[model samples]
Target: MEKILVVDDDLGIQKQLKWSFAGYEVIFAEDRASAIAQLRRFEPKVVTLDLGLPPDPANATEGMATLEEILELAPQTKVIVVTGNNDKKNALRAINLGAYDFYQKPIDSDTIQILVSRAMNLFNLEMENRHLAAVAPSMDKIIGQSESILAASRKAERIAQTDISTLLLGESGTGKEVFARSIHEHSLRKDKAFVAINCASIPENLLESELFGYEKGAFTGANKTTPGKIETAQNGTLFLDEIGDMPIGLQAKMLRFLQERVIERVGGRSEIPVDIRVICATHRDIPGMVAEQTFREDLYYRIGEISILIPPLRERNNDVVLLARTFLAQYNEEFKTKIKGFSEGAIKAMSQHKWPGNIRELQNKLKSAVIMAEGTHIQAEDLNLTFNNDALSIDTLNLREVREHAESRAIRNAYQIAERNMSRTAELLGVTRPTLYSLIDKYHMDDIKTG
Candidate 1:
């Protein structure tokens, strides 16, 4: 039989629950310490914790601490918090702290048993889903189980065997180059070189020569015949990062090369035939640029024959914690530190944070946290995130109302975090001061003192 750990100070309640849970082997603990001990020993799938424990039976301080410790040690365990009548506030707090669910006291054995049964079913379902996701084919470098990322990975896998020109679109730091390299590695040209160049980083005057090569004495500094990225990637793949930033003048030449599979070196008349696959990536709006006449429409169509949009980290649910744990292990080994895991506050703060910079931002934060963290577990403070227990309440089903609620909550949280400083709050929310003020007025939040 599966095990259930019951933590309560009252013998009557424990005895009643013991009788209530008939099919499961139940373990009892009257205090926080013994409860954790039982938890480590049995590794129960579910735990029912009372918010009133010994040495602080009247208050929930010890109970809250117990909840945090339990989650810290066994984050996958489904913890159901039991609270007194009129103690819904503490129950909600427990939920925010990662508890599975809560129950109010004057316990009905039948009702509590029903709740426990549901929790067990949900836990089993989650474990099965995790097992399935783990078994799914995944990219070696891409670490994510979210559908958005997995879909993108599947698309990449399907296209990896082909030599078609591909385009990857995503926000900066979303690892477009990583996908490009993965495709190259999976292709028939795996043994060949994979050359990468950033169009935006190279100067306009030098980019043409860099992509198409320069002949001997092509320019003042052209001392010898040197192959450019295109030639260097012969029989392999060329990753042109920030392709949207390629100048319109250069786009025509790139278009010619793509159409004919040949190129002319700088100051050289002979057209050089090249055999290479091209993968382009950018965070800019290429179609918009084409419309504005800053980029050629033909070049746009050529490079974007097959395009994939990679989702930002914010859109990936639960992947934040998963990726954080993976990075924590890596950083721990690299830094030679034994940092165990994230604190409950850190986990909550990470889930709530809007990761504007995507995976790169998370990686940077974890690296620093690993090196600088004081305790065994990394806290929200270590990651520079606020440990705000009050979460946004989603009480409505309307889409517009949900967006409005999110906007208002984000504005309020940023404003408070910024100490009512208008500029700082606007910066935090990634909006202008005028827009911030307009939102505050629209939300009837003029009561917020702005400095």
Candidate 2:
């Protein structure tokens, strides 16, 4: 059961509070000294503090001191200060001093109880949100930790604090949307909407109206006045996905909106202002398109203030294995299966396969495999990878080859994950720095970039 600490000097009020709250386990203290003692002992999530303690029942001095001390002792506790009917000044002062809320009293059971309940609810909600923020992954929760992906992630994060117009350049299925959201999540506009519109998905005829609003009776289908995606994302983020595919005629209007933070409706003359951070993304070669005169050079310059290029799956060595395992675990829980992990042959096949569709393709394959897997462990055949036994069996049978292969891969993955901080990589590989350098030299991987 939840606990509430009531700190009031009046005996009658104490008894009234004890009887009023039936669901909560109410504890009482009559002075600041006793109240603080009960607070540390019980560590109650909520507190009702009356600013009418001994030596200052006529004034708010003693009670305000207590409130300040209570907050200093436990910053997380929600302390609600009760004051006299006309004591608005002291109530506001208590709030400034970090008290959760203030309530003026002739303490009715219904009204005071409701306020207390609301405070309790808010306290719980804030705690939960804090917990989620603590465990939430960086890079917009994208899973791979390879050097190429990490390099892009570092650049994205470094630029996330400002309101720069960010352009994400990557091949299809390389998680451009995920990185775009990382920028939003790390910015000043995190609390507001992260609105996204696919310029390629919507038809050219409808795309303009979708981005900018139209008045009532503007057209045959426009029976009611409608707000566009740009207006709806006020004081937030507007993600323009597949911007390379936007119509050439509409590019001039978009450029105007970026230059001046205002937009005109499809059939209206008045320019409505909007406050938003614009982030664009595309899988197409936008620069090449500009050279070809298919895409506007002016619009390209407007959105490309900070461009981050995400590497495709094949170039990110060992990331395919990492991403596959993450997808396997996710699907196992969703499908309610007990599939342990991938077999050696399955891992080899996935590592060598060209992931043309990238992360999206890998996820779909794993989702299908989890559903089709009949045994506790998924095999090579489950993912439709041909296990060339005659060719690969000799290598798998050699203990020295297996150990050396695993050791080399482990060292490489650790080095990348640590972003090539030599000390960190050494610690992760459970070796001295000199030992790690020796292994690197022995493996003939000195040409690989460590930065």
Candidate 3:
């Protein structure tokens, strides 16, 4: 049976609660010390804490202290503070200090039982969710179950054991570097250094020296001979992030290095051989850049020998929730806060938001929410996502408009789920090919491409 700890100094209230909670192994404690001892011994999931103890039965100091201590010991424990009928102030204070819920004196047997039952239910639900999250589907170091992510991961896995140049294509903040590291970690050179450099972050003037190193007195600031990123990863992998941002001048040098597996440092004469695998990532359309003459086609083809496209968070279906839960658990442990989970509205908002910034945005919002959230559960407001109102406004009550909106949404979703295959989309939507095309034209969704 589940244990319920009732901390009350009054004999009458203690006897009343014991009889009131006959279905459980009820434990009683008269003071803070006894209450903590009973809490440690029983480890009850639910506890009814009275604000009046022997040390200061008339005030709330001892009771408040006990509540803090209980939560500090076990943040998961649901402690319902019991205050006098007029002590709602202290009750609210206890809640801010992390008490699960609060109750008032002269408690009705039915009301108190309902409160305890609700807390127990929430506790069990959170525990189950935690266990489920622990075993959530993952690919190597990646956390996702969407077909888009899985497809990308499978491609990465297949080419990891090879030395082929890889290009990771994704939107900004879509964890491109993570894919790069995962590939290197799974490669033959896992034990060797995995160097990463952002082409966009480095200046055009210094980029060449950064990538190819420099000899002593190569420039005014070149104090000594130093190895470039490519040379440093002699037997390992070099991740050139935002490779599309690399200058046209540098592209030729980079191409030569890739072709010869050798480099000549700035102001140096001898060609230095460096056997390193190259992995490049960019959020830009390198093909478009090549067509526009802004990027070198030869370099693009060289680095993109094997390309993997990582889908944005918005298109990953329910993977957003999985990622959010993972981040919540991580931040919870990092901050030493026991946030049970996200509120229903928060989850709904997260699912609805487009997540334009992808995993990085979600991570930032979740970290801030974890630290700033006042309640046990993170709310929609904490994440800065608007909680959608279920109530239909007068403007949205028109049947024809609502039908059109729903149909458009359904068609788009079906088209995506069917991987943009017209016949498959029609079959999924239970519509003829002509009808699907008509709907797509009606919605003006011709630009929707499979990313």
Candidate 4:
């Protein structure tokens, strides 16, 4: 049976509701304190909040405070604010502050019951939608809701419909492979294999043979004819990561395979036809490499028929917090921890981070923090950021970049100057303790002396 919490000052009205809504196990509260107490204890999915309570039954002061506290603690619970007689002003304010709905009335039993039923139905529907979204595949794995990421996602889908050779460009750990797999999932070749190889991870001598299979006795250790990634990925998609690292000599061979959908086993002349689509990704500056006569311009254009540049974490506003929350939820489930969300200071702190390692870095921080967070909310101290100086060298001239670097350096210096005294550090900088605390997040000075 569904439970309902009824909060009102008058005993006559409360008693009337208890009998009127006999279908539900209704609980009663005469003041804001008892109402909130019942709310936390019961975890009721539905609440009939009154805008008139004992402390300030005249005005909606106490009632409004109760409403705010209820929503803050349990945002998922539907709060239907019961407004005063002809008090439309406070009623509208309640709705704006995330109340499920506002009901103004002399409290007709049937009408209020119907309203409560409507809120419950909506709650059930939303819960279903959330469950479906969590299990959905592909780009669903890409967590940010920022417009920048959504735009890139839409573009990736458009490219997926066709078999054009695509190139994913982004800094390391921005989820290049995740986007690649999303393309494969929605593409015509969804059932077949999606093979991937990193050019940087494998030795140059073995990379050529790794992509193009060798015949038995072709090499000293070749005991049997083993197919390479391209052949292994026949009728599927072959993802060549770090494509810029392929030797200049081998680039011509790769171009030949792309230009004609065929390959020759290393020591054999049999023209093996392969019906496979090729996708490549590289963080290295291929165009610059082409100008320097290192990377072949011809091969560059072939693999980049459709190019998608993944926006870095810092460039995607609001995405940092979005990704952080997503990672927090994921870690909570994986670690069997019940950490709720980020602190206000933590959100601001995460927002300003440069995230040199991008999504991978953010994910790592949260995974460790969820395990370490002692409180219900993961605070700035829990994230323990470590600034990577290598990312700062990219654009030292930009004022924002320079300022961010300077601030981090100053904070580190200030903490040391004050002999690890956080209060003294704030006083020395002539800012309040709270302001200094937020600055610690802005700079991600996690390891700095904060005693």
Estimate the TM-score of every prediction. Answer: 0.62, 0.58, 0.61, 0.62
Model 1 CA deviation exceeding 4 Å by range: 1-138, 392-451
Candidate 3 residue 72 Cα shift, in angstroms, is 18
Summarize candidate 1's per-residue lDDT along 1-451 as a digit string, tens digits. 9899999999999999999999999999999999999999999999999999989999899999999999999998989898876676787688778887777767767557766886798788679867866775336677777999889989998888888889999999888998999888888898999999999999999999999999999889899998899999999999999998998889999999999999999989999999999999999988888889998988889988899999999999888998998899899889998776776557878988999999899999999989988765787888888756556445547654455557767887898899889999999999766556545533434345543
- The lDDT for every candidate, in the order shown, is 0.85, 0.82, 0.84, 0.80
Model 4 bad stretches (over 4 Å)? 1-138, 386-451
Q: By lDDT, highest first, what's the ranking?
A: 1, 3, 2, 4
* True-vs-predicted CA distance for residue 22, candidate 2, Å: 62
Q: What stretches of model 2 exceed 4 Å from their correct place? A: 1-137, 387-451
Stronger candidate by lDDT (1 vs 2) = 1
What would you estimate as the lDDT of candidate 1?
0.85
Which candidate do you rate higher for lDDT, 1 or 4?
1
Clashes of each: 0, 0, 0, 0
Q: List candidate 3 stretches off by more than 4 Å.
A: 1-138, 391-451
lDDT tens per residue, model 2, 1-451: 8999999989898999988788999999988999999999999889999998887789888899999889999998998898876676787688777777666666667546655776788688668756755764445466565788888988887888788998999899998998988889988899999999999999999999999989888889998889999999999999999999999999999999999999998888899999999999999999899999989999999999989999999899878987887788788789887676665556767877788988888887788888987654566667776544223344367654465467667886898899888889999999766556545533434333432
Reference-based lDDT, residue 63, model 2: 95
lDDT of 3: 0.84
TM-score computed on alpha carbons, candidate 4: 0.62
Worst 10 residues of 1 by lDDT: 438-447
Prediction 2 global C-alpha lDDT: 0.82
